[model samples]
Target: MTTVRIPAGWPATEEQARAVQDELRERVVTDEPGPPPRTGQVTGVDVAYDDERDVVVAAAVVLDAADLTVVAEATAVGTVSFPYVPGLLAFREIPTVLAALDALPCRPGLVVCDGYGLAHPRRFGLASHLGVLTGLPTIGVAKNPFTFTYDDPGIPRGSVSPLRADADEVGRALRTREGVKPVFVSVGHRVTLDNACAHALALTPEYRLPETTRRADALCRRALREATA
Candidate 1:
């Protein structure tokens, strides 16, 4: 696998991080609502890192978005090249994710990521990185906001919030299931935020995260754990 160096201590200087983020914001593709998405399969992609072995594990899990059942699952492993910078997360995880996608037995209609989408500082988070790299439609569902801020819309589930980077509304924060924490939803590529949020909601019935992320995250952890065990 190809590699890119992360800075010595991992995280970047605040200034350097901000610069990269500003560059990303300039490249945002903010068009209006488009055509409807076809009813099709959706996949979840996630990564778990093991610093001791300098390894990254990726998982891709496809599911029936309408029914929330697994269709296919794949896992891949690779080295971590980049350091863990706050905003520049895509560079570190995407390589392994591609490997995970390559191992998939079936192609998914779309991908839901456990990271950022347009909610990123550059407006291109993990979903955007993976989508463009693989040319697949993707959305990001993150547990926390990186550089974006918004109201939490209270709890009780299904509460919605608009994510703002500075002052611009980039995406929406969605609660997947009742009593579950909200996941930030944004358009990563070839999709709209609304569509992405709808897809995420359709794939969830239990837990805080959508089934794809929940399962894929588990798969990635298992892959790394079993390998090092």
Candidate 2:
């Protein structure tokens, strides 16, 4: 595990954070198709918070894209840099997440964030922010669609529907299992929306959530417990 500290001059107000978001949002790439599914390495990144302690723990778990076997993992604990604000939650987690990813032994080919990307109200979320900073391909596989509206997808595995904000389609609600609630997938950086959905499905072969997410989630929570203890 690694320890991280908030950078100097980190945003202290919502206005400052939103200004940063607006500037960085323009740097997010959306043209590249990114790496193909079931190839190279795919990493899942998640964070756990202990608000009372003002601490957050982040975990990054890299898996072989073909078989979903764990290749490498790292964790970082840090002071929460920002308060719990909806749509701006990434600021609280990114520093620790960056430390965790930096500690990994090998390259993280495609990063999967357990949060939003283009599906965000500002069109820039954790995955996009991480990608822009690290120059890595990334996508978001979120459990909920945030404020986006979507029609129900078919009751079958691999079915999908557009997640819309008003008239613009921002992402997809992708069903990874039959009769299960779909996961929301969106382009983060260097990836298209269709490819993002495909990667989400490829990662979720056995459950509603991807193995990468499941592993990272558990590891982050464990790291948080250990840090707080």
Candidate 3:
């Protein structure tokens, strides 16, 4: 595990954080189709928080895209970097996440965040922020739609419904397993919404959530327990 410290000049208020988001949001690349599914590496990143202790633990697990086998993994623990502001939650988690990613032994390739991307109210969520900062192809696979509205996807696996904010199609509600609740997928940086959903399906051969998310969630929670203990 790596230890992380909040950088000097990190956002100190919601206004500052939003300002940072507005600036960085313009840099998020949405045109390019990212790496093809089932090729290269796909990394899942997640964070676990102990609010009472002010500790946050983040994990990054890289899997071989073709076979979904683990390739490399790393964890980082640090103080929570920001207050819990709804749309600005990225500020609380990014420092340790970046540290965990930096600690990885190999390139992360396409990153999948267990949170939002363009589906956010500000249209810049954790995945988008991380992608702009790292210049990596990134996507978000979220369990819930946040404040967005979406029609239920079809009951069959691989079906999708558009996740909408007003009239804009911001993401997709993707059914990765038949009869299971769909996961929300969105473009973060260089990836398209379609490819993001495809990647989500490719990563979820046996569950509603992607393997990257499932593995990283478990790892981060485990690291948090060990850190607190």
Give each prediction's root-mean-square deviation over alpha carbons.
Answer: 4.1, 0.7, 0.7
Model 3 C-alpha lDDT per residue in residues 141-218, reported as the tens digit of each score: 999999999999999999999999999999999999999889999999999988898899999999999999999999
Across 78-188, the per-residue lDDT of candidate 2 in tens digits comes to 998999898998888898999999999999999999988889999998889999989999999999989999999999999999999999999999999999999999999
Q: Which ten residues in a row have the lowest lDDT in candidate 3?
A: 80-89
Error of 3 at 124 (Å): 0.5
Which lDDT value does model 2 have at 133? 88
Q: What is the alpha-carbon lDDT of model 1 when measured against the actual structure?
A: 0.75
Off by over 4 Å in 2: none
Q: Global lDDT for candidate 2? A: 0.93
| Number of the predicted model whose lDDT against the real structure is largest | 3
In model 2, the worst 10-residue window by lDDT is: 84-93
Model 1 CA deviation exceeding 4 Å by range:
1-38, 154-156
Models 1 onward score TM values of 0.83, 0.98, 0.99
Q: Which pairs in model 1 have colliding backbones?
A: 6-83, 24-122, 25-122
lDDT of 3 at 177: 93
Sort every candidate by lDDT, greatest first. 3, 2, 1
